[model samples]
Each structure stands twice: as C-alpha cells, then as structure tokens.
Target: MISAKHKLLLGVAMASLLIACSPADTPAAGGRPAPAVKVSTLATEVVQKRVQALGTLLAQESIDISSNVTEKITALHFDDGDSVTKGQLLVTLQQDEEAAQLSSARADLAEQERELARLEGLLASQSAAQTEYDQRQTAKLRAQSKIAEIQALLAERTIRAPFSGVIGLRQLSPGALVSPGTSITTLDDLSVMRLDFQLPSLSIKAIAPGQRIVAHSDALNDDFDATISAVASRVNPIDRSITARALIKNPDQKLKPGMLMLVSITTSEYDAIMAPESALQSVQLQHYLWIMNADQKAERRQVELGIRKPGFVEIRSGVSVGEQLIYEGFASLQAGSTVAPQEG
Candidate 1:
C-alpha cells in the first residue's frame, strides 16, 4: 500500500496536523509589576477644641415707653432716636381740666380753713355746739384730701423717662388721642450689648461664667471679644440645648439690637495626637486611615476621633504619633500593598 509518491504526500499531511495540535512557546510566569503609588504623611500636633454658634445682639436694658393716663397728647419733648436722661420729660398730656380741678380743690380748702378759724372762735365763746364744731373740722379735712387727689391726677398727665437710654421715634404727635398703656416709644441702653444663644446640653459642663468668647457679625465686618455672663438653670427638653448669655462692651455703640452674630467658645484643651483633616478616610459607617509600616507596606487602620478644628482633628485612639499616614492615593492601594511615602 505504500508507493514512494503516496507515502511522501501522507507524511506531509501528518506533519501539518502535529503542528496545529502542539502548544507554542510563551513568556515567563512572572514579571515586574506596576509602579508603587506615592502618598503624603502627616505629623501629630496638640490642638484645642472649640464650639461655635449663632447668636443675637441685644441691648442690656430695653423698655417700651407708654402712657398710664388716657388723654390727648399735648406735647412731645423728645424726638425719635434721641438720647434721654433719667426723669426727663418725654410726653405731656392736656392738663387744663386737671389744673382746674386742682384750683377748685385749693379754693374749697381755703374756705374750710376760714370756717375752721371762725368755729374755733365760737367754741372759745361757748356759742357753737361741740358736735357742730367736730363736723366742720371733718369738712376741712375732706377738702384737703380732695386737693391731694387732684395733685396726683396732674402728675399722671405727664410721662417721664424711667432710665437713661436712647428713645425710639415718637408714636403719637401733638393732638393725638392716647389711652392708658399706649406705647409712646422704645428706650434702649446701647452702651453695652449682650449676645444670647443656645448651646448643646452636652457642653453645659464645659462652659462657665467669665469664659472668653469670640463673636463675629455680618453687619460688622470685624470680630469682637465677649465674656460669658450667664447660663441657664435648666436644659430645654424640646431642643436639648441650654441658654447662654455673653456681654460685649459697646462703648462706641456700633452694635445694635437684632444683629446676628457668630459666637466661638473654647470648650476643651488637650495634649494628644492630631492630624490634618485630609488624612482621615471613611468606609461604610466606620472611619479609617492608611498607616505605612516599617516595611513600607500600607496597613488599613480604624480610628477613634475627637473634636475637629480648622484644619486638624484630634486622634483619640488608633494610630500613634510619628507614624507615616497615607493622606492621598488610597483608591489604588489595599492592605499589605507597597507604597512610596512622600513628605508633607
């Protein structure tokens, strides 16, 4: 079955089949991997904890001035926004009727005094009954009481400032009908101002009277210093906050009532390890950071945190001081991965 020509053709076909089934030569199993990722390191520093809040500036003393007597306003001696001294006359009511009543009482009292003198002369002569003289004396005393009552009415017709303060604009003009308890204007002592704000109940123990605070207002482009004046006796259950008051001296009277301010208070001090805010990482509900070991391998670390400052945060637990922390390029690395530490 094997002629020379046929055998040569069969051998060629078998060689082609062997070449198709065989595996080709390949590269080595392992080679150099991708370059290591570069990251920055952070150093620990001591920091202080501070709390901030929004507050309102208010006058130390403020009152709404009003009239106690119902009458037509006869005169307004002070204009709106004028500074007034204590006991200064601010408003006057129509006193003509009151003055007439006073005059009538005084006339009646004078007539009673003359009658009393005549009764005394008659008593000395034994020409007047003892009961009649006693009645005349009672009439004279009643007239004196009438005079005192009219004087009180006249005093009520005039309104005076109770304290030294700046007065608001007049609410009623001359000839305006005003009733009892009508608000004439507001008086506020702006020499000293106070900021009222609420702090979290948890911070109540840390805050104390006389603690220094910094305040900034949008109305005023500068920051000012204030001292804690008072604290609330009880915590508010609805908001879980405590009320606090701070006094800021306003000698220039630049700050006004109703201005919103930002209050910053130092709550705590510590000598612990702190790191830049960028060094912290979060995974799921837990916070983490990458620590470079002595072998230059990236190690995943869980951390406990404390108060946060402007650019740094206090480390309560986990990493120690002087350890190389990866502040960047965490997305491409895993635990035990090699890292190139960069100074930061």
Candidate 2:
C-alpha cells in the first residue's frame, strides 16, 4: 500500500540489522577470543570388575516348631520371642493318660521279667519244659517292647527345641488344644545370615566358595561383608543362571531373614583408563568425547566404554592416558572447533 520510496527505506533498515547480527560482520579488531572449557587428563587406575545381583537374607538355621501329637497344652515353658538353647523345653501337653499307660506297662514288664526268671531257673533244674521256658521268655520280650513304645509316646507330650534359636510369637496358649501339625511358632538362628542370589551361568568360572561379596540392606542402614558359602551344581534351565549362597556374620542381629539385599560380587579386576563423565557425549547410540589436539582444536573421538563410577567412566579404547579431555562446555564444541584449556 505504501509508495516505492518508503518500501526502499524499509529494505535498507533490514539489511543493516542483518549485518549487525552476523558474527562475520561484527568484530575483527583483535580476532575472536578463544572459547574456554574445563579439561581433565585421562588416567589409568586399577578397578574391580563387578557383577551385580539381587539377593535375599536368610537365617542360618530356621524351623517351625510344632507338637507331634494332638493334646491340650498344660504348660508353656518360654514366652514369645524367647531365646532358647537346644533341648530346652518349650511346651508341655496334658500327659496324664500317657503317664498312666506307661506305669501300667512298666508293672506288666516287671511281672513278666520275674516270671521269665523263674521259668529259666526251673528249666535249668529240669523242672520246666523247654517249650514252656521259651514261651515265658517271649512273653517278657513282648512286655519290654510295650514299655518302650509307651515311653516314646510319653516323651512326645513335651516339645523341646531342636537347636538354639530365637523363637517367634507363640500361636497356642496354655490350655489350648493343639492338633498334630498345627502352627506353633518359628525358630531362627540369626547369629549369622545366609545370603542367596543368582548369577549367570557364564560366570560360573569365577564363582567359588570363600570368594568375597558385599551386601547392603536398607533396613539395617549398614553394609555387610560375606563370603561365598555354596554355588549351584547345575545351571537352571529356565533362567540359565546358577544359585549362590553366602554366609554373613550378624553379631548385632540387625540383619534379619527374608530381607532383600543388594549384592555386589567381584568377577574380575583390571587396570583401565578413566575420564571425567562430563567429557562424554552421546549422539544416538554412539559415545563421543572431545580431545584437545596440539593445535588447540577439538577432535571428536568415538570410544568404547566399560564400567562407570561416580564422576568417571572407564575408557576401554579410542582414548589413552596422558590425553587432555574437555570436561565441560561440550555443547559449544564440534569436530575441529578451537578451544582454550581451563584448569579443573
């Protein structure tokens, strides 16, 4: 809508703005200042090759304590969660019937024994028949067998701990009728914890008893040191992994059974060149790093990486020790870009 002269003035103003914004048209008084960047020198160090796996903490020994016979509990020797020793009586059931039976059997056994003794004396004196003496002896043996069986039944009326452990909550109170195989309580030997984990079968060559492994538990807020106690004899068909178990001492009783643990196992060790993680750039699937060449220019190099730690990453190849790496200002760099080294 404007006149041709006005349009020509507008075009001139746009041309001036473009020239002011252009880097080429701006400064040539002393050439461009070098872009400064933080740098680090690659260094070689020994590092452990670790294999990570999830694991579980378990009691060294654990069992569910239950009575073998159904009977009314007459007495409870220990409270819930009591620490007990091996053979310590935990519960006693009503055993009046068993005791009566045992007493009767003992009396019968005594009578039979005396009768057999009399028959043997008579047989030695030729006063009793051989068949009769043999019969008496067999009668005594049967009576003895009856007494033995009754003794076993009476012993079952009292339940004792099979091993030293801490007992869990008691399910039955005094006077409660407990049936055979009913829930009673749990016992756990927690002085030492067992760590169970699975590892790939391909790493079987490196796994062995006595190998050191480290474990961490969130519940304890501490770390535990353990040693490999066992390794699976065969690989699992479904997962293609092998089960392993380690023994960790738990003197403070902080680690408990069924706790999930983060475990680290050392599979190998080697020396590798490491560089600051900040220096690395990921373009698509490849990792690239900028290195300062002798001419103070950035050279992008693709590298193979291994294990990564806090602020550093392993450089398996494509970079060597004594090389200067650009650790910062990576966004402003490219292949053959000029850079000024800044101390880090």
> Least lDDT summed over 10 consecutive residues: which range in candidate 1?
25-34
Candidate with top lDDT is 2
Cα-based lDDT for every prediction:
0.83, 0.87
lDDT of 2 by residue, 102-153 (tens): 8888888888888888888888899989998788778878888888898888
- What digit string (tens of lDDT, one per residue) describes model 1 on residues 182-253? 888899999889899999998887779999999998777889999999998989999999999999999888
Deviation from native of the Cα of residue 327 in model 1, angstroms: 6.3
Error of 2 at 194 (Å): 2.4
lDDT of 2: 0.87
Give the true-structure RMSD of model 1. Answer: 10.0
Off by over 4 Å in 1: 1-46, 114-137, 208-212, 279-303, 322-344
Window of ten residues with lowest summed lDDT in model 2 = 25-34
State every prediction's TM-score relative to the real structure.
0.70, 0.81
Mark the regions of model 2 whose C-alpha exceeds 4 Å error after superposition.
1-30, 112-139, 293-297, 333-340
